[model samples]
Target: MESITEEQLIQMVRDFIESESSAPQISVSSSESHIDSDHHHQPSNIDTLEEMIWRETTDVEVEILEKILMYMRNMGSLIIEPKNLKKWVVLRLKMDGYEASLCKTTWVSFPGRAKGNYEFVDVITNGTRVIIDMEFRSQFELARPTQSYTKLIEALPSFFIGTEEKLGNVVTLLCSAAKESLKESGLHIPPWRKATYMLPKWFSENCKKVSFSPNSNSTIEEF
Candidate 1:
């Protein structure tokens, strides 16, 4: 299969979100008084998206995932495992007494195209099934100093860094980690749509410097 371009990747994800959002919700009829004995909780939209995307595969997906894995290994302690066909644990970032589970999902296949199977990333936290929207693509800007941490910080409730000062520090650390990871992975992000962005207006005055080195500071535990 041909490699999927980054724009195609982003477009695929956007399309998937739009399609799922537009889908009509199924309602149960009152005539059916009893639910099935084996009925289970319905999966979230993200779960459905993941399942749908995982059905297709491509060389681009492999290349993208490999880059992410290389970058993750340099960041901190990680635990990698396979969950199943539609889902699996690629990396569990363990640091600051918290864990962020990163997985591959959202394989992009156009409505009628079969060769373009691009994948996207999702992060989950410990003891929870909710997918934290990092808004990575929304935050991507090639000209800025990557600021991909708002959703991540909000999602990581277990982490102690919450104050404006500490939060900015953590954000900076994350941005740096992302930069290093992408660099090491040799991923070519366009100049106009780089994975990083300038600090938001609010962060301009609140950012505080903190000592954080993914390679030197954090311990590594691979599984």
Candidate 2:
């Protein structure tokens, strides 16, 4: 990726902020409608996990998440592929003066895990790193999910923007719950769904950071 000049970055930020300011504010309760209609009947554990997710989110993360949501609402239709969408999001975050990058993580097969690679975005502010997964809830979907597990999945956000530690905690909690849910339904838990396997998709040491530039080709650096 080529580098964008400071002047260009400033102009982009100004335009984005102006457009965002004109848009109507979104209500927090509006998201509740996306949940399953049966959410009211969900078990206590699902409620606990939902509470934990929000409780761990910091103010900075929330602000960034709102920008992301707005961008998706206004400009997402123009982008068709997931990779391009992520790249655009990184550029937008940079315009907002956030240290954001597109990260690609690849892992080799281990004794009990399969080889796989994944891509997502991350932003650093005030010495804290936050992971952003646009496809967060789908990662936990099962072909034949138990009613309980389905309820749990419904409680998750379609996109996640939070600290790495909090994400890890969520993975652990969800994976454990998944195992139990599957067991209750006489189904076997897949290795890919285990916390040990899923965690590396974001935390792997083999991550490559791709920096965006508007004027030139993007550059990749191994982390």
Global lDDT of each candidate: 0.33, 0.72
Q: TM-score each candidate.
A: 0.22, 0.74
TM value for model 2: 0.74
Q: In candidate 2, list every pair of residues with a backbone clash.
A: 1-217, 1-218, 1-219, 2-213, 2-216, 2-217
Candidate 1 lDDT (Cα, whole model)?
0.33
Error of 2 at 95 (Å): 1.5
Mind giving the per-residue lDDT tens digits that candidate 1 earns over 53-154?
Answer: 332323334333334334434433333322211122222222332233333222222333222111222222343222222233344222323233233322
Identify the candidate with maximal lDDT: 2
lDDT of model 1 at residue 160? Answer: 18
Each prediction's number of clashing residue pairs:
3, 6
Which tens-of-lDDT digit does each residue in 1-223 have in candidate 2? 4443334433444443443344333334766646676666343666567555665458888788678656555552242343465777788788778899999999999887888999999899999998888777778888778898897787676667789888988888888888888888888778897888999999999999987764445522210
Error of 1 at 222 (Å): 22
RMSD to true structure for each model, in Å = 20.8, 9.7
lDDT for model 2, please: 0.72
lDDT for position 117 in model 2: 96
